[model samples]
Structures are given as C-alpha cells and as structure tokens.
Target: MVSKLKSANASAAGQITSRSPRQIAWRRFRRNKVGMVSAGISIVVLMLSLFAPVVCKILGINPDELNLDLIDSSGIPTLPNGGISWEHPLGLTPGIGRDLLANLLYGSRISFLVAFLTTGLAIFIGLIVGIVGGYFRGRIDDYLGRFTDFLLAFPAFFMIVALSEPMVARIQETGIAQGNGARVIFLIFFLSFFGWPGFSRLVRSQVLSLRERDFVTAAQAMGASRKRIIFKELMPNLWAPVIVVVSLSLPGYLAAEAVFSFLGIGIQPPATTWGILLDNARRFVTVYPNFFLITAGSLVLVVLAFNLVGDALRDALDPRSER
Candidate 1:
C-alpha cells in the first residue's frame, strides 16, 4: 500500500513538471485582470498597425497620396462654414490635404516597428555585455560597470541629436544609405548603441546575484564548461527579469523614436511616424482639437498599456509574490 501511494505521488509530480515556464507564466498572467486587459489592448493596437492597408481601404484614404486641390488647414465645422464634416473625420491640416486616419495608421506602423526592432537590438547587446561582465567578475566587470555609468552620465537625447545629422550625412556620402532602407537601418543602429547600456546594467545586476546561487555552483562542480554554464545555466535563469524589462522598455523606445522623428532626425517624410503626426497636428490643435486628441491620445494609450503590462509582470514574477 505504501509503495503504491508513493508511485502515484511521483506520477503527479512528473506531470506537473512537464509544463513549461512560459505556459506557467501565461497561466498566472491571465489570472491578473489588468495584465489581461492591457495585453488585449496591446494586441489590438499591434493588429491595427499590422493590417493598416485594410484600415486605409475601409477609411477610403490614401496614406501617402495627397490631394493638393482642397484648402489645406480647415478647422472643425461647428457652423455651416466651420469646414469639417463626416468626409474628413479629424478635419484638415495646415498645408496638406492628407487623410488624418490614413496618416495616423501609417505612422503607427513606423512607431511599432521602431519599438520592436530597437528593443530586440538593445536586448541582444545587453545580454552579451551582461553575461560577460557577470560571469568574469573582477577587473572586467569593474571596467564595464564604470564605462556604462560614464555613458549614462551624458544627456542622451542631446547626444543622439548631435550625432544624428553628421551620421546621416556620412551614410549618404558613402552611398550606403542613399535610400529609405539604409536610413531606417542607420536609425535602428543609432538607437541601439545608445539604448543598450541601461539594459546591460540591469542584466549585470541580476547576474551578479544569480551566479552565487547553489544551482550555478553545482553546475560548475559538474565539470560544465564556462560556455555551457553561461548559456545553458545562467541564461535560462535570466529570462524572468529580461521579459519584464523588455516589456517596460518597449513603450519608452517607441516614445524616443517619436521624439527623434518629431525633431526631424527619425523616419522622415513619405515615412510618417506618430511623433511626426503630432508635430504636424500641433499647429491646428486650437482649430480642430480632435486632430490632436485622437492622434496624441492614441499614442498615450499605447504607451500606457505597455507600461501597465510591464508593471503587472514584475509584480507577478516577484519572488515575494504569493504562489
């Protein structure tokens, strides 16, 4: 009877162990109402941005093709001659007869793309620096830690702006980035270099704490090579903090991209961005407040959703969080 009971318990434990960490995370994440709600919002926004062509078709607007005939900057119609109608939902802008809905959708695409790409780049760079600094731990770690601090001390935006114009000109001269693709790639790289230090510092801090744990010590004792220990052992342990940080950093990166574009250094004309749309919309806010409200309001919602989700994940994954 005792032997049979022990066998049943082992079977139940084995079944429980079969579930992956991601599957477990999803289960916990779904139970949190705010996380689920914000996740739903994020998904909807991403879908809208991804299927922009369909949206443009339904809205009956060409995002890029402009109409020169219409009066450029008409405000919202209150009286018979106040100017806006159902045809122009958000009303017209200063000098461009472009569809506000279409431009907003197009800009969403750029903003989303920049966020996704830059986050990926930042994580990759951070992971490499972090793993190296943490695993080696000595003069190497000290040097890297100090250097990251030094980089962080600078005013990031001003530095990016100062670097951008010269870099873009240099790339154009090299005939490397004469077109849109090159320009986008350069922008991605530019953002990546400046962005990684923060993530690297975060990862390094996590690694320092994790490396002294019993599992890592055991792995080292088992004759595991440094590569195997770092990649197989340490990397797996780092995923929780990584996921939380990435989700939080995404919105910030998107906002930064918008700021860059607004300043005329990011995705230029013919390639609209949420920041650029807001920049153009600023002049007509007093006239047609809806123009600013819809575009800027949407930007705020997207950023807030990401931030809220990140906050929930951090709480859920916290060591002190109740099981």
Candidate 2:
C-alpha cells in the first residue's frame, strides 16, 4: 500500500511538471502554418520599427534630416548622388529628399505606437464596462448597454471626422511642443474613442456566458467577493477570447489610422506614417507606380498577418480543442 501511494505521488509530481497553458498555446501556435508566418511578419516589422535608429545609422542617413537637393529629380528614388545606389532603393521623396526606406522604418515606430495604444486603451475600457455590466445584470447593465448602443450608432469614420478637428486644435493649443509625439497621442485618442465599443460588446457577451459557469458558481459558494470573482477568476478564464480580440483589434486599429491619414486627418507633414506614405503615392500612382505598390503592399501584409494570427490563436487557445 505504501509503495502504491509513493508511486501515485511520483506520478502526480511528473504531471505537475507538464506544459502550462502558455506553453501549450505557444506550441500550438508554432504548429500552425499561418500563425507561424504571421508571427514571422510581426517579428520582422516590430524589429524594423524598434531598430530604425540603428538602421538609419548604419545606412549613414539621418531619418529626420532632409536633403532638398534630391527633391523632384526622381529617376528611381535612389541615393542623393542620383545613381542606382543600393542604399535608397525606393528613392527620395520630392520635398524632404529623405531615404524612403529609412523614413518607412522610422515611420513604423509611430504607426505601431498608435496601433498598440489604441488597441490597449480600447481593451481596458471594454474590460471595465464589460465586467460591470455582465457580472451585474440589472439597472447598471441596462445603462451601460444603452450607452454602448449609443456609441455604436455612429459610423466610426464619421465619428472620427467630427472629433478630429476639435481634438487636434486642442492638442495644438496645448503648447506642449507640437510634432510627431503630439500627433501620435491624438491619433491614439481618436482611435480609442471610436474603437472601444466593439471590444466592450465582445467582453460583455463572454462575461455573460462565463458568469453562469460551474467554477464561477463554486467561487460564489465559497464566499469569493464579486470583485475577486470577476477580475481574478472570471477574467482569467476569458484569456482565450481576449487574445483573439486583441490580435484582431491591432490590424483594425492600423487600418483606421491609415484611413484617417488618407483623409488628411492623421500623421501630418514632417512626420511620416505608412498611411501618409500611401496617401503620397496615390497622386503619383500613374507616374510612379512602384511607390504605390510598395506602400500598399506593406500595409496589406501587416493587416493580413494580424488577421491570420488572430484566427490561429482562436483555434489554438480554445479550451474544447481535442488536445
């Protein structure tokens, strides 16, 4: 009997050392072809954005410093010397004469910042509203539900248009030193204001279902506080859905930024974003088609990567999977 008990203890110890939820999720993600490809794209893009300064240094180009000499001369959008130097393959812009590649890499930093901030802010606001509304299904829920409906009633683009002018004006008046930093913050705010409702609705639906689950009931029976149950137990269980939503939200946020810029409301002069780059290419698409192709291609890749990864995460993280 003692030997059997010892054997059982050893077995339990071995099981305890097995892969965790995160490890399992990672393994599953790696096994997925689309997920792996998406992850690769995400890593490359993030690295390019993060190390823009280093890349600029290695290329002997100041990302912010403009060279007017190359402006409008445009043979192939290459180097300052006008030869097909491998340094600036995309060529220099007309006004700034900055290396397109360098500007692209640098611009990604701001674009990524806006996308991430917008998604995070939306998620946070959604979580708060969702938890409160879902855990308590009464007057509070009704009020919040109605408020969410009101937010949803407006077309996202129209809402952004209406808000951008006043918000941008306020940021300009703040005197906190204008330029890239200010623009990024304001864009994030704009995206968040229009973006949060979708996430809130998602979370609310998930929480409404989760609140009735057995574990939740057990926690309630064990005298767990509503706060603890909602934040700790309930929220943690919603990780699968949250991961999927966040992954999807990122690309949507990026697209929104691009649209705003395309409409002349986003990243402005002296500060370049992928959207602004695309906007610039729009006028010259017939003349300089490469410009449009490169810019549009990059944006498409980013959006597609996010969507593929989000779908993969949803499948891999599902608790009911036949693991």
Candidate 3:
C-alpha cells in the first residue's frame, strides 16, 4: 500500500512539472488584464493594416485613387460637409480628397512593418555579437565592446536625419530603391543599423552573468563545441530578457519611422503612411483640424498600445514579480 501511494505521488509531481516555461509565462501574461487587452488591440490594428485592401473595398473607398469631386475650389476637402460619412468614414483629406480611412489602414501597414522588421534585424545582429563576445571574453569581447560603445556615443537620430535624404536620393538615382518598396527597405536598414547597439549591450551584459553559470561550465566540460554551447545552451537561457528588450524597443522604432516620414525622409507621396499623412495634414491644420487629428490620434493609439503591452510583458516575465 505504501509503495502504491509513493508511486501515485510521483505521478502527480510529474504532472505538475509538465508545463513549459513559455506556457507558464503566457498564463502569467493573461492574468494582467491591461496587457491582454493591449495585446488584442495591437493584433486588431495589425490585421486592419494587413488587410487594408479588403477593408477599403468593404468601405467603398480608394486610398490612392483621387476624388477631385470631393475637393472644393480652394482644394480643401469639403469639411463637416464631408465629415463622417458611410462612404468616407473618417472623412477625407482636405486638399487631396483621399479617403482618410483607407490612407490610415495603408499607413498602418508601413508603420507596423517598419517597426517589426527593424526590431527583428536588430535582435538578430545583437544576439550574434553579444553571444560571441560574451562567450569568448578577452580580445573578442574587447573589440566588440569598443565598437558597440563607439556606436552608442553618437546621436542616432541626428545621424539618421543627416544621412536619410542623401542616402535615399542616391538609392533612387541608382535605380536601387526606386519605388515605395525601396524606401521601405532603406528605412528598415537605416533603423536596424542604428538600433542594434543598444540591444547588443543588453545581451552582452546578460551573457556576462550567464557564461559562468554551472550549465555553461558543465557543457564545456562535456566536450560540447563552442558554437553548440552558445546556440543550444546559452541561447535558451537568454530568451526571457531578449523578449523583454524586443517588446520595449518596438515602440521606439515605430516612433522613429513616423518621425522620418514626417520629416520628408520617409515614405513619400503615392505611399500613404501616417507620418506622410501628418506632413500633408499640417498644411491645412488651421482650416481642417480633422485631418491632423485623425492621423495623429492613430499614431498615438498604436504607440500607447505597444508601450502598455511591453510594460505588461516585462512585469509578467520578471521572475521576482509576485503576479
């Protein structure tokens, strides 16, 4: 009877330990109502952006196609007269007569794409640099550390602003980045280039603490290859912090892309982005405040949603958090 009882207890313990770290983290995240709601909002925004064409069709408006009929003699979209209609839900651009809803959907596509792609690239580069540097401390670490410091010393935004116009112009002139596609790629590269160093530093710090842990030492003693230890052993342990960094950094990248667009260095005409929309709306802000309000409001909502989600993730994943 005692043997049977011991066996049952063992089985129960195994069942309790079956849950993976990811599953546990997810359970914790779901408990945070604010985070869960923000995540849902972010998902909805992404879907709307991804399916902008279909959304536009359902709404019966063309984002890029001109609607000169809607424009007045002064070239401003007919205001309150044009405001909040079934055909143009968010009203129309004052001077251009483009559907505000359609433009917003398309613009969201650019903003979200830039933020995610740049963050992905930065994470990839940072991971490689940090893992290698931290694993092989000494000369390799010194060289990489200096390079990262050098990058951090510069004002990243200023560098982007100064280089964007000339770099974009050259790419266009060379037929390298001709259309909106080229501009998007350029922005991705530009943002990723400036963004990686911070993450690299973060990863390097974490790696420094982890490299001396027992698992790493045990892996080394067992004749595991350096690459194997770094990728298989070390990488798994780094996921928690990496995820937190990625989440926190996304909003910053989104804001940067918007700033680039607003400054005329981002996606240009024929390509509707929130930043570009804001740039155009600014001219008619006095006469038609709706145009500016709609675009700015959308930007604010996305940024705020991302920030809230990130904060929630940080708290949820924090091992010390009681929640």
Among these predictions, the greatest lDDT belongs to 3
Task: Indicate the worst ten consecutive residues by lDDT in candidate 1.
Answer: 75-84
State residue 100's C-alpha deviation in candidate 1, in Å. Answer: 1.4
In candidate 3, what are the lDDT values of residues 1-323, reduced to their tens digit? Answer: 99999999999988876777788788889999999999999889889989999988987888887788878887787646555688789988877788889989988888889999999999999999988888788999999999999988889888887887777777889887676777788889978987898888888888899988999899899999988988888899899988888888888888888888899888887787888888988998888888888889989988888889988888888878788
Q: How many clashes in candidate 1?
A: 0
Candidate 1 residue lDDT tens string, 21-46: 67767777778899889989999888
Which stretch of 10 consecutive residues in model 3 shows the poorest summed lDDT? 75-84
* 1 versus 3: better lDDT goes to: 3
lDDT of 3: 0.86
TM-score of 2: 0.86
TM-scores of all models? 0.86, 0.86, 0.92
lDDT of 1 at 92: 48
- Stretches of candidate 1 exceeding 4 Å from the true structure: 1-24, 67-94, 179-183
Which residue runs of candidate 3 sit more than 4 Å off their true CA positions?
1-18, 79-82
| Model 3 per-residue lDDT at 77 | 77
- Give all candidates' CA lDDT scores: 0.80, 0.80, 0.86
